[model samples]
Target: MKKKFKHIKESQLTITELMLPSHSNFSGKIHGGHILNLMDQIAFACASKHSENYCVTASVNKVDFLNPIEVGELVTLKASINYTGRTSMVVGLRVESENIRTGEKKHCNSSYFTMVAKDEAGKSAPIPGIILTTKDEIRRFARSITRQNEGRHRTSRFSSKIFKTDAYIHLLEESNSKIELK
Candidate 1:
C-alpha cells in the first residue's frame, strides 16, 4: 500500500528559461501574467508530488513583483509544498532572474498558490497531511495556517455582502456541500 503518511522534506522544483522575443512586452519587461503562469505550473508540480495526484489551483494567496526581468535574463522558478489540508495544499513559489552572461541572480517575484488534488473523475480529492521536518519548514507551515485563518475570517465577514444574492448564495451552499463530502 502507498504510505499513508509522507513528509515532503526539502521538496523543490526549478525551471529556467530565457526571456524570448515573444515573451517580452513593448516596455521590454516580462509580463506579470507570464510569471504568474509559470508560478502556477511550478506550484502544481510541487503540490502534486506531495499529494501523489493531479492538482488544480484553487487560489493564489499573494503575488508580489520585486523587480522587472530583462529580456535576455534567464527566469528561474522555484516552488515547494509548504503545507497541506484535508483536500488542499499550499505551495510557495519564488521567481528569480539570472543574467547568464554575468552569472548574477536576483529575486523578481514571490507568491503562494493553493492547489486541490483531483480524483480520477476530475473531482476534488483529499491529500495526505504534511509533516514538518525542519525549523524553517515548521515556520512556513505556521505562516500558512495563519494566512488560511485570516482568509477564512475575512471571507466569513464579507461573504454575506459578496454572496448575499440568491443565486450566489445557492452556489456557495453547493460548493460548501461538495467540500464537506471530501
Candidate 2:
C-alpha cells in the first residue's frame, strides 16, 4: 500500500492550563519540570496525530527555558510536526505564559522532541511525509536536518573511544570546574 502524506498543519496542537500554587517551586515560579512534562505530552499528541499510530519519544532534542512562569499565569503550549523521517518525526514545541490580569504573554520555552511511530506489535512504523505549506514549514524541515546532522557529528566526536581527553584538557583550564586526572 502506498503511504499517505499529512500536512504540517494537520498535526498541530495547542494546550493551555492555568498555573496553580502547587505547580510552583520554592522560588515561587512554576517548576521547569512541570513545563517539560506538558511539552512532552503535546509532542506526543502532535506526533500521534500525524502518524496515525502510537508514538513514543525517541529523543528529546534541546529545551531552553527563557522566562519564568508565575503561579497565576496561564501556560500555553503549541506543538507541530517539524520534520518526518521513515519512522520518526521531530515535534517542535513552544511554551508561553500569559498574565491573566494584565493580558500579557511571554515566551517561556522552546524545544524539539523526536518521536517514533509504533505499530501494534511494538515495532517502529513508517510515518507519513510532511506536506510543507508555508515558508516557515520549509525552513523548519531544513533546520531539522541540520540539527540532526549536528547531533550525530557531536555524538561521534565525543564517543568513548574516539574522544581525546588530552586535546580538550587545555581548553578547560579557563573554566571554573576542577578536573583531577588519574
Candidate 3:
C-alpha cells in the first residue's frame, strides 16, 4: 500500500544556516546568489527526505526578496516539500534573518523550487506522491500544479521557437563544441 503524506509540522525540520563573511558581498547584505544557494540546499534536503532519493534542482519558479540580511545576522533557511509530480517535486522555502544577540527576526525571502530525483544512471526518476492532509496544503498544491503546467507550456513554445532560429542553433552548436573540447 502507498503511504499517505501527513501534514508536515514546522517542527519536522530544523532551520539551516549559511554563514556569510563581510567579503561575500560589497553591499554588506547577503547576496541574492548566496541566499539562493542556501535555499537550494534546504530544498534538496526536504525533497530527499520526502522522496528518499537523490534530488536535484530543476528550476526556481519564483523568488521574492522581502528584506535584506545583514552580515552578522544568522541566515536561517526553512523548506518543505509542498507538491510532487511523476518526475518533479516543488519545494517551498522561506528564508529569515535573526540577530543572535537581540533575538529579532525578519523574513528575508521566499521561493519555490522544482526538483527532480535521479536514478543511478542519472535519468529522471519518479518520486513518491504527495497527499494533501490539510485544506491549506490542498490549496497550495493546486496552485503549484497550475503554475507548473503554465510554465511547461511556455517552455515548450519557447524551445520550439528557439529550435527554428538558425542563430540560436549556431549558438548552441558553438557552446557544444566548447564543451566537447573541454
Error of 1 at 157 (Å): 2.4
> In terms of TM-score, how similar is model 3 to the real structure?
0.76
- Compared with the true structure, what per-residue lDDT tens digits does model 2 show for residues 40-151? 8999999999999999998998788899899999999999999999999999999999999999999988889999999999999998999998999999999999999999
Question: Which sections of candidate 2 miss by over 4 Å?
Answer: none
Best by TM-score: 2
- Displacement of residue 39 (Cα, Å) in model 3 is 0.8
- Clash number by candidate, in order: 0, 0, 0
TM-score of each: 0.82, 0.97, 0.76
lDDT of each: 0.84, 0.94, 0.77
* Residue 170, model 2, lDDT: 86
Residues 32-128, model 3: lDDT tens digits:
8888877888888888777677989989987888987877788878787778788778888888889888999999887898989888898887777
Name the lDDT value of residue 158 in candidate 2.
94
In model 1, pairs of residues that clash are: none
